[model samples]
Target: MTDSKLKVALVGCGQIADAHLGEIRRILCARAVAVCDQYLDLAKQAAARFGVPGVFTDLGKMLAEVRPDVLHVATPPHTHRPLALQALAAGVHVYVEKPFTVDVTEAEDVLAAAVAAKRLVCVGHDQLYDPAWQECRDLYQRGELGEVVHVDAVLGYDLAGPYGRVTASDPDHWVHRLPGKFFHNTIAHALYKITDFLRDEEPRIFATWFGALPGTDCPTELRVFLQGADVTANLLSSSAIEPSQRVTRVYGTRRVVEVDLDGRLLRQARAPTLRGPLVKLELPWRQKREAARSLRRNLWHFLRSRLHYFTGMHRLFTEFYQAIRTHGEPPIPYAEIRRLMAMMDQIFRSCRANERLSALANEERRLNGQPVPISPLDPPLTTHHSPLTNP
Candidate 1:
């Protein structure tokens, strides 16, 4: 829409804002013109950090004055809906953080607003843009990995960290207020990575929740099984565990590829021979060659420091910016966003229903004088939680 350079404005000054600032600075077609936040000092700090000349404590004021071509809604998930709607209403394209809204209805509303305003909205589902993830996608697309059989997307968290501690201690925190709570804020990272490979309109879910740290009300340990028509996906987010990593392992009919997102590594495993012990000898070499290639690529990124950390964000932002500048289709389509939100809403609702059903089954057994046993509907314990299916 812009023949000239795009003026990008960011509306959050938190940690993720730094990533947006970096990429906005790097993109030749766009520049950070202003930043806004409720905290004036945070806005000032980001403005100073990014050399953004305009800063505002109010988003409305910033929109009225600078009228940025694109706005990044990096605020908390709860604030995403209103802020995004506001940006669309003002005829500004929006890029919002993951879990684009707290729930499906809000996501739909934002999409509708974007349509009405003739603007675009891109979710910060940036992980799939990471180099390693992109390579994995390419492999699948080219049929080098064969048909995707299953997907396992895992994310680990450190509960002692600032975010965890803050949410754990504050009952009134925006995270706790979310319909899906902490999981809502994060499930997108795990789900969006592999959902495209799934063919089903609505995947059935089996979920499990437990607190790794006893006496804590927050369910730090969680897992979900997503059953697709052709490919199944396992989504894991465990704050109770350590060795924090973001990884997605894709199983294919002919081979399996492991996409280590945090490590920025990709490995392919395949039948190295038509027959016999030769494959035993050939497979390791094949894996080693792939790993080494990935290492070289990652090393190149590492030499750059800050860019290495925000590589995916940078790529995602660049593509979105280019599409806007060229009047091309949005980088991620609105229908995809709708499908993603629907999947998430179903996951949250189905899991809660599972919990309630489990409780009810227990009560039923006690009243009927039958021996109490674990309900089949109840999530079974494993590295995975139970499936949360819609009744």
Candidate 2:
């Protein structure tokens, strides 16, 4: 709460730390003052890359010496809780990366610590602040999208992608140790968007998971159905799908809004009023117009250098810093964060239940001298993996 630029420190100099550092530099009200990592060399490397003035190998040393106003916890999911609690206790605001904690219980603890310390905390649900999503939210708020009825959130993964390949090959990765396994690290991206639109306090969740990859226990595919008071939602995360997509489509009583997160595009589809041949002739024309509009908008953004892959992260950082300066509500509410974590807990619980049932069925089949189906929940299939940090 300084009138001058805020001093920022980052812990966990992992892959995601680079993004956080870069975005912090973009915020005029904040600057990266120091960085810390368990490994000294990694800390030095991040400081050198980001031009951060201070570097340390220990969290306590960095906190006491640099005394930053805000701390970014980009560490592994399992480490998030302890690291965040430590920062909050030191009177530092915190911005934790996605999947805030391994589960809801740890998340609650971190929030409680923030309250006790009279500090603010924010989670990295950056996609919700992306341009396309912002537009969708505006439309919904303005009654352009009408009454919300259902939502479909889909995230596609590539098994051979940079981070994916590392987790697939390294059996000892920290992500593998999370309670929800790999899904815990990535599902928050899809769930947060659903929770934004479906406001029911106690939503009912039904989840199914499968290991699409023959040799992996990672459960590469997940499907979840959620029922709110008046809105229903479906979430999907799949590695088998080609042309990897990140999209959320919200269906309302009057129209549908599709947010193409990867492409940074938003589209609206309204109920057709034209009849017979006119309806057929009009829809394609409308689609073509939307396509052309998207092209122009994207081209403009590209020329202006605004179409960045991390635009959402930039916006979230700016808003969080503003909240710190103004003592205003955070960009993403605490209640929403808690609700999303609870939803994730329910999803993973269902996955674990399915595993138990599958095991019992296989055991019964063995007693009957029949061939037992391979269980996707078998050992060595890998569990949790993080897109942010390995440490």
Worst 10-residue lDDT window for candidate 1 reads 377-386
Candidate with top TM-score is: 2
User: How high is the lDDT of residue 239 in model 1?
Assistant: 84
Candidate 1: stretches off by over 4 Å: 1-3, 212-216, 274-281, 303-307, 362-391
The residue-by-residue lDDT of candidate 2 on 1-391, one tens digit each, is 5579999999999888989998888888999999999999999999999899999989988999999999999988999999999899899999999989888899899989988898999999999888889989999999998999999999998879987888777767777777777788898998889988899877877676887333446677888888888999999998889987899999988789999988787788987889998999888888888778888988999999877888899999999989999998888888888988888888887676666666666676688796776655343212332111111
**What are the lDDT figures for the candidates, one per model?**
0.82, 0.86
Query: Which residue pairs in model 2 clash with each other?
Result: 175-384, 175-385, 176-384, 181-383, 181-384, 182-383, 182-384, 217-381
> How does candidate 2 score on lDDT?
0.86
> Measured by TM-score, how close is model 2 to the native structure?
0.92
lDDT measured at residue 289 in model 1 versus the true structure, 0 to 100: 94
Query: Model 2: residues >4 Å from true position, as ranges?
Result: 212-216, 365-391
Q: Lowest summed-lDDT stretch of 10 residues in model 2? A: 382-391
